[model samples]
Target: MTVALMWEARAVAGRGADLLAWARAQHLAGTPLRRETFRAPQDRVLVITWWDAAYDADLPELPEPDGTLVGRPVHRWRFEAVD
Candidate 1:
């Protein structure tokens, strides 16, 4: 099965670039299949990750920045292959 995990996080003051860099490093370390970022009108950042079973097994816990702003909440969606 394939799973797409959508993680929404608020960009902390002076931390947006750092957060993005960390995410990029994680992707390069083989954590997720593909990663994409989107910005809302309110400046909220949304990150989407696509992963397979293997990728899921290698998933890592996200880092939390001290005194950083967080998004409304975290949400996830799962999908399976159909034929």
Candidate 2:
């Protein structure tokens, strides 16, 4: 079965570029990552990443961000692939 991990977090002021660079490096390192950013009504930045499926036995540990807001939270969701 295939599984996806979804993560969301708030970016620090003027830190989007750095965070994106890190994410790109992670993608190149072999995680099938799709990412995007958007602005909140209050002008804060939100980043979301979708990771491609990996087998439970072969799952890789995700990298952690160096800098971000204190209250920002990350979430993950997993799903099985269907034929």
Give per-model TM-scores.
0.54, 0.49
Extract clashing residue pairs from model 1: none
lDDT tens string, model 2, 1-83?
Answer: 45555444445666655554555455434545555645543224444444555545455534556645323544445555669
User: What are the runs in model 2 whose C-alpha is more than 4 Å off?
Assistant: 27-58, 68-71
Q: Give the range of the ten consecutive residues with the poorest summed lDDT in model 1.
A: 65-74
Name the regions of candidate 1 deviating beyond 4 angstroms. Answer: 12-31, 54-58, 69-83
Model 1 agreement with the true structure over 1-83: per-residue lDDT tens digits: 66666665555555666556554454344566667877654435567777676434545434443345443444444444456
Winning model by TM-score: 1
How well does candidate 2 match the true structure, expressed as C-alpha RMSD?
4.5
User: Per-residue lDDT for 78 in model 2?
Assistant: 53
Question: Clashes in each model (backbone N, CA, C under 3 Å)?
Answer: 0, 0
Residue 83, model 2: Cα distance from true site in angstroms = 4.6
